[model samples]
Each structure stands twice: as structure tokens, then as C-alpha cells.
Target: MKIFGYQLGGEKRSGSIENPTVPVSAENFMQFFGVQSGNLPSVTIDSALRVPAIAAAVSFLSGSLANLPLHAFKPKGDGSERIKGGIQKLLNEAPNPEWTSFGWRKYFWQQVFTGGRGVSWIERNGATTAAIWPMDPSTTVVKRVNGRRIYVFDGKSEYPASDVIDVPFLLKKDQISVYSPIMLGSKAISLALAMGDYAGGFFAGGGVPPLALSGPLPAGADAIKRAQSDIRRSIDSAKSNDEAIFPIPPGYKLEAVGFDPQKGQMTEARRFQIEEAGRIYSLPPVFLQDYTHGVKANVEQQDLHLVKHVISQWAKALEEELNLKVFGPRSNGRYAEHNLDALMRGDFKTRMDALSRAVNSALRTPNEARNLENLPAMPNGDTLYIQGATVPLGSQPLLQAPPTGKENDKGNENGDGNDSEA
Candidate 1:
């Protein structure tokens, strides 16, 4: 046998190769396997957005980080001086001409989830950062030359490592960029989405019937053919409305052919898909709307977990990138940080309890606690008030015995003479 000009199970014929080309690309690999090219997985960012699980994960992460306060601070003594004015406006109000801080953060976070890299251009003024603009990940590429990494934007412009703030997710060794979740779990995501589409179509088409007609046909061949055509027409027409009856001729009976949705495990399959997607994003199943195992008590813990594990990582990445590109190395002790208290804020009771403890323990002043709640400060709120009974261990008592009035009276009576006692 001869296969692609090569002998198989036959005497080999030696000949000098006329032409040869290295198969390095995906297309070439597929061609070698006799599979048609250009059939790449259809799991792009836009397509994945159609999945609820992907949408929820992206939203939860981006929204949580973006909505939280991001502040720049300069270390001074025991506290820090918040960098205000233009810098603060750029962070809290607008990061660029087109997008606000929230929008910018959300866009970059989405990029991280979809493409594994979030890149932005740092626009500067004199010695301070003016604005930060996001670059589309699809058009942005990272290249290394002469032991220095360079960022190429849209294949037209090149930016130095210092000018671009790059946050890569799931970074690997000896690699310039990060690994995308969608790319790594494309097969699973695609399968889940495909199943969802199928289920939607199934329900939309009035679902599968309980049973299908089978057995022998009645009378002549023409009658049998007519009966089959009528049955198909009836089935197709009845799909529009489940209440529509499916009529069958005599001598024909319905027989179970397919498993019901419950027995087929459709719901379980969807639940599994949700869990899989959550795992890919490092999110809890509850965040993806899978509340099967969720409880009210654990929900708060889950949120905390989300902050500690998922949101904190992204926040730290953004903070470091901002500190480096926005503030630069010469900034000294200046750095950016996200206030996670916003995410940790629970109900009224929780907030009040935390504030009470903070104030009573002298960790924060009453004015500081009120400021966090956006309330006005009181006259003496600046004073740090702790529990009157709370005292340092191994320290003298703050209270001392009262001065004796008789001692003072004796000093007055005797003048320069010795003191007298009762």
C-alpha cells in the first residue's frame, strides 16, 4: 500500500526528497492528521460571555475590585500621607479619556480572565502619571530582544517595559505572557455551552416525547408510507405546543425510545458545568449561582474566601503594576493599595460591631470610624478612647488614692511646724 507517496506493508523505495517543509503551526499539524484546518475552538471572550458562569466570575472579580477604593500612600512615620489632587482624581474618577476607573479596571480584569494578560499604557506628565489607558489584549503582543522585554501594541507601536503596566494571570516560567483560562479549558467550556444550547433547543422544541410509535404498519405499502408521513407531520406540528395531540392510525402503539430529562441527568450535567467553570476561575460554586451546597452562615465565609483568594490576588497585581508604572522607582516609599474593607462590609450589625471594637480598643478614633461610615465627626471624636477598665499588663494602676484633706489642714495650722495626724 502507498500512503502519501510512502510505502506501507510493501518494499520500501529510496529516493531523494524533492521538497520538504517544517510543520510548525497548528494548521500544518491538523493537515498532517488529515483534519481540516480553520476549525479552531469557538471559545473566544465574546463567546464565553454567553455562558452565565463565565459572566458571573468576570463580573464578581472586576466589580468587586473596581468598586473598592484604590488609594496611593506615602509612608510617613507610623502612618502614610495619601497622594491627593490629580493622582487621586485619575484613580477614583477617571483613569483615561474614555473610561472611568471602574470601567478601566473592569475592562482589564475581563482581559485577564479571557486572555491571561491585562495591559495598559501609562500616560505621564512631567514627573507624575496623567492617565492610564487600556490596550486590547488581542492586538497587544510581548516580545523580548537583547535581554529586554518590549510591548508591541497593535503591531504598529512599541512601548518600553516601564511605560506599560502588564498584569499576567497564571504566569509560567521563562514566559513573557500568562496562560488564559479560556484557552486552557476551552474543551470543557465549549462542551458546557454546547450542552446548554442543546437543552435550550430541546425545551424550545416542546421537549422529547414520552414514547414514539413503532411496530408494523397497516394494509398496503402506500398506506404504510402515508401513515409514516402523517406521523412525522403530526410530530413536527405538535412541537409548537405541547397541548397539541399527536394522532396515530390503528394497529400502531407508542414505545419508549429516549430517556427523560431527569433520568438523562441534564440538570446534574449543567450543575457540573457550573462547578467546573467556578474551578477554572477559582470561584466558589455559589458565585456561579450554584446554591445546592450553600448555606447562609457559609455564604459570608465564601465571600471572605473570594476576597482572600480571588480578589486579593487581582488587587495586588494591579497595585504593584500601578506603583511601578505610575509612581516609578524614584517614588521611594510611595505605593498604591486597595481598601478591602468595602468588600468585607456586611450588614448594619456587622459594621457597627466592627466599628465599636475598633474605637473601644483604641485601634481607631471615633472620628475615624465615623468617617468610614461617611458621617460627620463630633467635637471630641479625635481623642482615642479605650475601655476605662482596660489597662496594660504588668503596669501600675492608673487610679491612685485621693489626697488627704487633714494633711493639708495640718500644714496650714502648723505653718513651718511638724504635720499632725487624726
Candidate 2:
């Protein structure tokens, strides 16, 4: 029999069409329960430890048991001794003693795949205590003094002491949502962004929802109008130029050109040209506002891929710009593999500092060196704005300058008195 896609060896499946029920016999019950009725239930499991078959049977008998007289049944001889033995067996099966003493290892850990006290943190006076993961050595869980459901984790070590870090959100319900960059106070939202669930992430990250165009007026109506106007102007210009060069060939009516009224104003000339062009000749209509909007929407929807590509490009540019050797697990389309093995085996603190330095080096700002004195300056009176000396149009400025008496003497000394070459 298949239960939740698992086959049970040698079990008969007999049940109703609407609500299927598994058949159970005294022998099958004993085998399934791991106890014998002959010993009067000597070794029953703990009340906290519930099995499917036992739970279902108890549920089925609850209503029926109420109808039967409670005082009608009598306890068998030494029944109290059997009960004591069962209780002892249950106490023996209660989880490891260290789990109870250390508080981090919770009882319901098997129900979840990710976290427990390993997932806990500490807070003080309604504030997060410190960063409490692999890096942190002393973070603990904080519980409200009198409340049953309130808890807080203070992340002072991971962040500045001033910020209040919300910890309940740090642990995500889904594994895919866990790798995102953590926000200063909003770890949940950051994780959502890293997982590429932008809309969900935005909501989780305390971002406002996008307004839909449900009524006659859209939220970005003004921007859309401006964009559409710009698009129309370009198309109109193209149409006018095309019309001037090639006026509609004689006797061809506009209706015969297959224009749709619902699609708004479109130039017949542009449509004809587009139709004439085959698939390969067709372009992306870069100037069209509607096309641009569609492209932007698609890119925004798949922004993670774009971000990854941009990061890769930046990393490559950084490698070329800075003469530093870089190392990454997934750089240059090759896996780091054992390249990081030594770092993993060595002091993690030193490795972390090295990684930070390398990343910062790659992102260093370019220097702007200049000779300030060589730059042009404004006139003394008009010191507010820098002005370049104006050169007169008619002649070279140096030649046009009013001549001093010394200049004429210098010219005469250079044989400025003209004489034709003999």
C-alpha cells in the first residue's frame, strides 16, 4: 500500500472511494503498535510521541467510548503495575538529557530541516543582542518576562550597537529564500531579494506594493503620456520624411492598408514599410514607447540575471584595472574546487580579512590628478565664472592688439619697411 508515495510491504488496501480507510486487525494492530495486548499494554510509548495508526484509532474510539458507560468497566488485577511499567518505558524514550539541559536542541527539530536553538539569538530591553551565526560565539535566545509568544534577538556584534536587528525573520521558511544579503534591520527582506522573488521580497523587505492601473487614470499616467508623446513625435517625423520621399503610390486607399482603429494613431507609411520588411529585416522598434515599456517590464521581472551579469562584468573590469591576483569559488567559468582548501583549513578570521581587502581593492575609486594653475581663470571683476580670453574674428588676436611704440620699433628693426624682391 502506498502512503504518501511510500510502499508498505504486504499490506491490503481497503477503503471508501471518497475517504479511503486502511484496514486494521488485532494482529496487524499489535505489529504496527509494537506492543502486545496479552501483557495489557506493558510498554506503551510517550503521550508526546504520536504515531499515525494509534492516533487514528484513538480518534475513532473517542465518540464511541463516551456512549459506553464509564463505570461499567472494571480494572483487571495488577493493572496499576502495568501502567507504571508503561510510564517508565515512556520516560526512558524521552529525548537525550543534554537536549533538555542545553535548550538549543529542541524536541520538534525533526519536523523542520533547517533550524532550532542553532537558529536562536538574544536581545536586551526590546533590542537584538548580537550576530548569532557561525561568526558569533555568544548569542542566546531572549524570552519575554511574562509573555508566552514574544522573543527578540539583539545583533550587536554583527551590526552597530544602535541598530535593532529583527531575528525571527532571518530564518526563512524556504531554503531558496535564505541566501539573500541581509538588510541592516530587515534580514527577511534581504533574503527574499537574493532568492530572486522580487515582489515577495519587496513586501517582505518593507517595500511598498506597485499600484495597478485599475481606473481611468493610471498611477504613472503623466510619465506614460510624456513617453508616448516623445514616441509619436519621432514616428511622425519619420513618416513625414518617408511621405516626402515616396508619396503613397497613386490610387491606393488608406483603408486597403489594413489599419486598426483600436491600436491608436499609426502612420500608414511606417506600417507599409514594416510589413514589406521580412522577419530578418524587422527591427526592435527602439523608439516606440510601448515597446520600450514592455522591454523594461521584462528586464525588471528578470533583474537577478541582469544583476549577476553586471557583477561579473564589474569583477572582470576590476581584475584588469587593479594588478591584484583574485580568487573566487565561481570565477572565470571555472570552479575553485581545492584552490580554497587551504583557506578552509586555516584561520577563518585571517581568511575573512583577506577576502574583504581583495573585494575593496577591486572597488577602489579612480584618482583625479590635475594641475590647477594651468586651468583658465575668470577676470578679476567677474570672478564668479571662469572665462576664456575671447579671440577677435577678423584677425589674429596678437596682431590685432593695439601696437605700442616699442612694437613699431621692433617691427622696423626686423625690416618691416617693405621692398619688392629684385
Candidate 3:
């Protein structure tokens, strides 16, 4: 079962010891796994990026958040924001000298997905955040002293917790930093990719049929070996040709060795691997292109589920980290929020219906609705309008009429007079 030098179902061996005097090349390590040396053995960020499912999941999450409007808000009595300006420019335009707002968010989310922790170095000027820069999570280390966490960058420069903004995926007991998903799920991901390689190799060899020899035995061991070699050469030549046909010797017959890919469930196995990788990142099967259990009717619900369960959690983590590091602990009322309206938007008719309800109920102004739709506002768009016929609760109806018989008396008199004249 061994593909590379590494045994498939056997005791594992460490690739290299920590603090080794001699440097080991990546190619040498990769060769230990029966796979080609060109493919690296270790599941580092670079290696994981090669896996399409992992790349897609990371891109979807980071890109989605990066594109969203991240606003800075001051808390109000009604649990709303007063839309402040202090951190607004920093978040919306550029968070640092090097990266735009979108670039910053994308980099942060990429780190979070790959390492389970996103670290950023904050540059502040007298209680105001001037700029920010993302730090390499792989090289950064967290150390605690005097019961306070300290971040050591590249084993050289040291920074206080307040100076660095850290968003962690999942924290372990007594640990200030988060665990890396890539490091934890490396084996599973590597195995899945290895299986993919194996499948590709199987097909690339032209589905060569197995050869069976029967009839009188050759007189000597050399003769039998020669016969077997000839048969293998013939099969190889046939497989290499476009037309997979070959002449068989008098005593040899050939049979197809394996089941069809469908019957053997090879496709299913590959699909399961994709789903499994998606699970490692808490992504939906649909995100990885697995639509076996999906229906068009439920697609929107599935998207909502992804936003609520996956993207929201990451968004909240980033928001809280930014609030704490960028705004400071004393700034209790200020926070960062990602506008998820775009992601949650439904079909045109559904969105219009919802907007209409909001406007009618005074929850939103006409101008606000127009702004959401990116349309020009009218002169009176600021006014909040309710249905004219809508009445207050527990109040008498304004349109109610007097008893029907009494109201019709005047009209009936005119009709009776006209009938007498006729």
C-alpha cells in the first residue's frame, strides 16, 4: 500500500527532528512518501494552497469579508451606531500604509484560515491608530510573563498584547494563542491529495489488462520467467498505443484486472475527500462543489447557513479584535462592524417586498431603501410614510359609516318622486 517510501498503514516516523544540525531538503522529505519529490511532503501553507478545496474555502471567506463594508460605529441608546469618523477612514479606505481595507481584511482572514490566528502590528499615535501591518503568523510566537501575554516576532522583536491585534480561531486551555487547522489536519489533507495522485497515475497508464497464463508448464525456471517477461512487454506496448489491442502467445490469455471506476466508487471516494477537507475548515459541502444532497429550492437557505455559521463567527472574531486593539479597552462604546446585507440579499422580488415592508413600518426611510438599491433619491425620500388607511391599535376605524338604512334615506326620496311623475 506504500506509494512513496512512507508506509500507508504502518507506524509513523518523524520527518525531521527539531533543531537538527544538518538541513534536510524538502525534496528528500517528499520522496520518503512514495510520491514524486516535486510534491512537498509537509503540509505548510504553500502545500495546502495546492489543494483546490482549501483554496476555494479560504478565498470565499476572506474575499466575502474583504468586499463587505466595514464601518466604525459609536453605540446609541437604541442599540444602533451613530456612524463616527475617527476609525471610519482607517477601516473603509486603508488600515495600513501597505494594504487597502480590502487587502487588510483578505490577508487577515487568510491567516486565520491557514493558521487559526491572525496577527497584525498596530502603529498608534497618541491614542489614535495611525496605521496597521499584518505579521507572519508562522514565525510569530506567544510567550507569557508576569501572567501577561507577550508576542515575540521572528524570535527577535517583542511586542505587548495591546500593540498587536490577534484574532484566534479556537483557544486551548491555558494557551493565549489559537491552534492551527493546517497543522492539525495536515495528515488527512495530504492523504486525500495522495489518493488523487494515485488515481491519476492509475488512469495515465492506459488501464492495462491483467495477463493470466495457463497450459503446459515451461521445462525450466528461466523459460517460465522469459515467457512472463514477454507477456508483460506485449501488454505494456498495447497499453501505450492509442488502440489497446495486442496479440497473445499460444498459452496466455488476458483479463481486465479491476472494476470500473463507478462500480468501485472511486469517484465517490474522491468526492468524500473534498467534503472532508471542507469539514476541516467548517465549510459546507456546497462550498466545495459537492451538491449531492442539495436542491435548488434550498440553495439560498444553504448560503444563509454558511453566512450564519461560518462567516459570521469569523467576522465577529475580527470585529472584537479590532475593537480591542485598534480602539483600546477604555473605548467601550466604539466598535467595528461588517455590513452583511449584501451577502444576505435575496432575489429582486423578495428584496423589494422586504424593503417595502420596512418603509411602510417606518423601520427604514425611502431614501435609505433607495440607497440600498443604489438608486437616486427623490426630494421627499427622507420622509417616512405609513399606509393612509392603517389605524392605531385599539382605536375606532376612521372609515366606518353610519347605519346603512338611515344614510340612504335622501337618495330613496328622489327615486320615489321620479317614479310618481312617470
Candidate 4:
């Protein structure tokens, strides 16, 4: 089968055909030949990360997700409780002696957010998991062989699908090749890099635009060169001395060339790039330190939106992958979950109030809340308690007794008299 398409070689011409196929590598052919020529700079993973907004989005998302507590648990009684040791230790503490859980997960997700995939091998000793080792995706090849997926490291050693944990930013229909974010947003990233370069070169050159020399008496090439040098010196001298005006060569005219930063609306364009970066990652602009549309309520809502829409989705994806690859499809009562509440926590007072409400409303036991807050359990804190007015679903109200018929009588003498008279 052909790697790219049915025709095979991109530069090959069919004997009966007049044209040749072009490969994707030539996508930036124009830029190479034209020397940029006002076209956007080429975009790569490194260049894309150079964009501040893109860098911030990747860092924030990867770190925020990796820092959350991932717990392993099994169904017990009416609910589930966290279990320690084994996979849990590998997930929450250290994946191996060489890497902490946070560090490993951070690197894994860094690849993912950059529109690549992450893969790790689950090292097992007999029936139990022993360690975890990260694999370099760039050198590893993943493909289906005999209807079974496998990982081939550097095209040398092979590992079964059951042992490798794989996560892709996006899966193609074939489930082998994944889409790269750098490629998807190449145009936008290229423009951002170009703008940054333009701004730097513009300011560094002392705001001098292209100038023309006309009506000069100079005859030789050396003389023309000398005249240009003199003009640059005069401009630099004025700028250094903070003068408003600088002298120009006799009978020569200097006109500012190209668009100024103000005319180009550079500020607004930069802000728009930040928004575009955020959009690429499904991240809200506020998280990228852009507050253009961020009012009080919107900023707060954006926080919620981050956890619910972005972080939660990614967390779930990782959790499911771990559960399947680590424990197998028939997990037999064991699974992994991320403590999303960690991200939802607010200020100290608000957090305390929320914990109190959870305990009082019988949503969570006092012991559970205390455990979340990292406090020691109080005596009998495990007992669930609800408001005094709240009762069992089928039980009568405990707050007020049923009104008696004797008290309801219209002509009761004792009811009409004051208690002090008796």
C-alpha cells in the first residue's frame, strides 16, 4: 500500500499523464523561493511554542492536569473508596524511581497538547504491575499487525498493545496517524511569528524607515555608499541626542516606508492571536492572561468552563486509558478517577462553607469532608447527618407534631384563656 496516496511517489509522472503529483513537503515552496516576501514565516512545533499565548496555554493545561490527584478505587458497599498501593502508588506518587508522577504526566500531556500523542509502557512483574516507563513517541512506530495494535520502538523491539498506554490528541480514521496542532494552525502561528519579527526589527532599527537617495552629485559606487552611511549616522546621532529632527544629505529626500505599528493595528492583532491560540486548545482566553472579554462574572464562569469542558474531558480520557491498559477491560471492580474537586476549590472561607454544606446536607460524611481538607477525622464523623427538619423519605415530619382535634375545637375554654390565668 502507498504511504501518502494511491499514486505512490509525489514527484513521479505517469507515462501517459502530463502532470506530476506534489507532496506536502512542498507546502511552503513559495516561501522558500520568495524569501518570505511579506508572506508569513514557516511554522513548526518549536516556532509555535515561541508564541507567548501558545506557550502559556500548553504550560497551564499540562501542569494543571498533571498536578491533580489520580486515585485508584473499587466498589465498596453503596459507594466507592480510594485504595492505595500498586497502580495507585504509580499514578499518584512515582511512576518509577526515575520519574515522579507529576513530572511524567506533565511530559505526557505536553506532547498531547502540542497535537501529538503520548505512550508509556506498563511494566508488569507476573500478575501485578511493577513499574511504568515513558516511551519517546517520535521514535516509536504504532501500527496494526494481524488485527492487533503494537508499538515498535525505533523499528527494533516490539511491545504488545496490552502493555502500552497510548493517548492521541486526535485520532485519524485509520487510528494510526494523528493530526498535529502546529500543522492545523500553521497559518495563524506563522503570522504571529512574522508580526513579532517585524515589530522587533522595526524598533531595533531606531524607527527609521526605508529612505531614497535622489539628485545626488556622487558618481561612483563608493560615493553612493558613503552618502548612505552619512545619512544613517545623522539619524543615529539625532536619536542618541534626543533631537526632534535630523539632517539629510543635500538634494536627497527621505520618506518613511512601510506601515507603522499604529497603522498596522499591531496591538489588536496580537490580542487576536492570543484568542486564536486559546481557541486551538479549547481554552478560554482568560486562562491565557487575556482579559479583553473578561468581566467579573465572565472570568469566574471561564474558570468553571475550564474544569468542566476542557480539563474534565481530558482527565476522563486519560483515566479511561489507564483503567483499560493497566487493569484490562474487565477491571473486576477496580478503576481510576481524577479528583476534579481539587480544581473546583475556591477561597478558604468559601471552601469551608461548601464542605460544611456537604456534610450538613448529607451529601458527604463529615469524615469525607475532613479527608478532603486533609484534617483528622473527628469522633463518629463517619455517621451521616442531615438537617433536623430533614427526615427519611417515608417517615412523618419530625419538626412539628400533627395538630390535635381537641386543640382545633372552636370553643375550647382552656385554649381561649391565657396560661397565666390557670
Q: Where does candidate 4 stray beyond 4 Å? A: 1-37, 216-220, 391-422
Cα-based lDDT at residue 182, candidate 1: 83
TM-score of each: 0.78, 0.15, 0.76, 0.83
User: Could you give candidate 4's per-residue lDDT for residues 1-422 as a string of tens digits?
Assistant: 34322345544433311123332236645443334444678887888999999999889999999989999998899888788687889999999999999999999999888858888989999878899898888888998999999899888989998898888888889988898776777888888998899888888877764555654542455666677888889878888899988887677767665677888899899889999998888999999999888899999899889988999999999999889988888898899899987774657887888899999999999989999988899999899988998657978755887877666355456577345546
Estimate the overall C-alpha local distance difference test score of candidate 4. Answer: 0.83
lDDT of each residue in 153-239, candidate 3, tens digit only: 999999999999898877888688687777778887786666666677677766432334544542344555666777778867876
Instruction: Point out the higher-scoring one by lDDT: 3 or 4.
Output: 4
Residue-wise lDDT of candidate 2 within 216-299, one digit each (tens)?
Answer: 222244544454455446546666675433222223212222223224333333333222221111112221112323477664
After TM-score superposition, the amount by which residue 371's alpha carbon in candidate 4 deviates from its true location, in angstroms, is: 1.2
Candidate 3 TM-score versus the reference: 0.76
* Model 1 misplaced regions, further than 4 Å: 1-41, 209-225, 236-245, 250-258, 393-422
Model 2 misplaced stretches (Cα beyond 4 Å): 1-113, 116-141, 145-166, 169-419
lDDT of 1 by residue, 292-407 (tens): 98999898788888888988888988898888888887878888888888874657888899899999999999999999899999999999988988667968757888987777
Which portions of model 3 miss their true places by more than 4 Å? 1-42, 75-86, 209-241, 248-263, 375-377, 397-422
Q: List the pairs of residues colliding in candidate 3.
A: 3-34, 4-33, 4-34, 5-34
Cα-based lDDT for every prediction: 0.79, 0.29, 0.76, 0.83
